[model samples]
Target: MKKTSDLEEQLKEITQQRNLLLKALDVLEEGIHVVDSSGRTIIYTKGCEKIEQSKSDYILGKHISEAYELDDETSVQLRVLKSGIAVKNHHTSYITSQGKRADIITNTYPIFENGKIIAAVSVNRDITKLGELTEKIIELQKNLYSGEQKRRKHANGTIFEFDDIIGESDSIKQTIKIAKKFARSLSPVIIQGETGTGKELFAQSIHNYSSRANGPFVAVNCAAIPESLLEGILFGTSKGAFTGAEDKSGLFEEATEGTLFLDEINSMSMLLQTKMLRVLQNKTVRRVGGNKEIPVNPRIISATNVDPMESIAKNQLRNDLYYRLAVATLVIPPLRNRLDDIPILARYFIEKNSKIMGKNIKYISDEVFEIFNKYNWPGNVRELEHVIEHAINMADSTDTKLSVQHLPPHLREKFTHKHHFYKDYKVNNLQQTLLDIEKDIITQELINNDYNITKTAKSLGISRQHLQYRLKKLNIKKQK
Candidate 1:
């Protein structure tokens, strides 16, 4: 019994020393975790806190059966726990906060000490910078491997130089010149215009022109994606925030060191407007379930169709956020206002689509110009393009001579068709012009009616003698 007791004491001492070494190693080693079979977390380190964005004290002494989630419902812990195996080296993504975003490299291991499962340890390494470096290498390789057949987009997704754009209009030329200058600066710019006015085009021009054009040019349509999805798309979430998280890289993250073009920013819900305001303010963002703040360095270029001030008054936007975004505002002239450029823009599209559709056609009639200049276009350039395309498809001749008949009915009715003169003549200035031109018309009508005063009065919607006297003052003869 005495010998047995001595052996037991010696074994206890060895176990104590080993455990001491382990605790010390846990402190010294960079990444650490303590997870149990339930896929619930038991404890994590300061390094793990830096990685997983979780503090040990906050999660201590609880039933660590729930696995960490990337979105809402998806869980790494649940998967690891149920399978009774370790999940190793899975990649996860981040929401771009400031320029300093991060990606997580994850490894999950089943915990065992003396032949029994106790906990799991997960190690995560941030790969934000690695991603950027890889992109650089890819770009370099492309430049090297295909030196003969060179085709590349500028960081802002545009080709450099006047030769890049195929328009000769003074407006487009001037706009491009100004845009190249705008790209050099880092300040926020507001692209204001009607929908389909090429606000995106200008935004891309500015981005490609800027010094930071080497970065990503991520275009996000605020109106296209719903608010719920946008939060995760913008800020990003961990392995599990709510569920089913495969880990996503938000647009903000994708645009690191580049420009983020928020198209139709006016359509963003007011709640997201407030959240966006916070991003602009801090230049750092916390993921949906993450505790650590990540930095981001991308430029923000926001576009809106509505007047910024009007949007604020309507309570659809936060005034503070508008001010930040509108630090530099560029109002893209509407297609109607820039009517001088329509011919060039039209030919460009026609040439492009014609090449694609295997059609060789050219020319626009002067009457087509008359219709174009006269029509009050509600849909702007996009509408015009559609109209031209329709006209082209319907044309019997190879030449692109679009006439009044070729115009869509809604557009054609406002001009000089005989059936529409009366209703089409409704205008204030023309009303005054008609008053002067009417007496001669009145006498002509009266003569046609054989000067029957009652019939003339009835037709003119006035007394017969009143019409005759007016004809005399204007010297419109009472024809025999």
Candidate 2:
């Protein structure tokens, strides 16, 4: 009798705790759904009811397939239950029995009991309204981008040509040579490089050089838009598809007979990448919420700020999509790797910004060149341009050249700490001269070997360890 009473007490406590947790979940803005192993809906919170436009009583105790318009393969909850895996930030859309559409990003997890999968839980966040808003914003941006074409004095939407790519490095020249070859064939091209390495510049150049140069050149940055809306934006949306969807043409259609440049393709969701691959393969695109397959003949050019193989290894990029898009690959070397171009680029930026700022900045000082050679340009040419623009902005009326004092404070401080006080040059200091010579020799060797430390060390007849130590002591770093 005593044991029975204790058992009853424990049951009561567990039920109470479960009720409390359910109540807490109900108060959240995101919907909470729980299902048994058999796919029956065991628990549905108030948030779930609100988002789905259905009452919890109607869903609870019903199999998920009957409760909602989802099957075993389509249902994330069921998928998690079967695989005992978590599906995180996965976007899906379905219609409620109430005739309302719910677009949501779901994070579904398998619930384990005693090390066995017993149930599944899902947290769904409504992105329907956000998707609508993004659509409106995208429409506005499309108009804005279209209007800029006239201002740029270019047909379609391209402003830069091959000549605009201001780099003399062999790597850049070779990349351009390959891009020009790709432009002749109407096949897809993939440009891979670090951020700010002008991957888009190469993409635009390829488009301008292609036969489709006369047609529209549509460009989209995959990372800029939400994954939920990106599909509708890339593929057209049909009117009556959602609450406020309209009959709109997607970028693929917009760039028909031209080029579609997908920047940061690695940022696209795998599901979207699959859709893109299908469209590329078929040369046709279907509108979201529509059943029509629109034929598109746009030359595809995709750019990624990540290595294709690395992104594929990490599962950030779809392997099939990478292979499909990389028919022609162009790799633009980072600014640090092409150190020889720095002087020419600096001079170009100086002249350009000097004209804009109404200054006569004629030269970059020798000391400034030395500092440039030492610093790793992580942000690449864009960073160099911005640095030059900033120096030009800060230049005095009497100054004829950009000097150490005129450099951005961060660069100025780094140079001062690493090298010497340019304000007080010590020409007779033999130790300082020797240090300068050693630093110059190392810098030259690094450049000669394409910044390969091992090769540089071997050429200098020093151990790799010794070279690394010397590099660290000298505060020399490769671009990240």
lDDT, model 1 = 0.66
Best by TM-score: 2
Question: What would the per-residue lDDT of candidate 2 be over residues 1-480, giving only the tens digit for each residue?
Answer: 999999999999999999999999999999999999899988899988889889988888999889767777767788899899899977777777577889888899998989999999999999888877776776554455444454774766667899998878898788788889988999888998998999878888888888888998888888978987789889988875643457999999999999898999999988899999999999989998799989998998899988899999999999989999998888889998889899989999998889889998998877688889998999999999999999989877766877765789899777655334223446798888777778777875664344667767987899999999999988787643
For each candidate, C-alpha RMSD in Å?
18.7, 11.7
In order, candidate lDDTs are: 0.66, 0.84
Instruction: Look at candidate 1 and tell me the lDDT of residue 416.
Output: 39
Lowest-sum lDDT 10-residue window in model 2: 416-425
Cα deviation at 147, candidate 1, in Å, is: 20
Regions more than 4 Å wrong, model 2: 1-150, 355-360, 418-480
Query: In candidate 1, which residue ranges exceed 4 Å CA deviation?
Result: 1-174, 397-400, 419-480
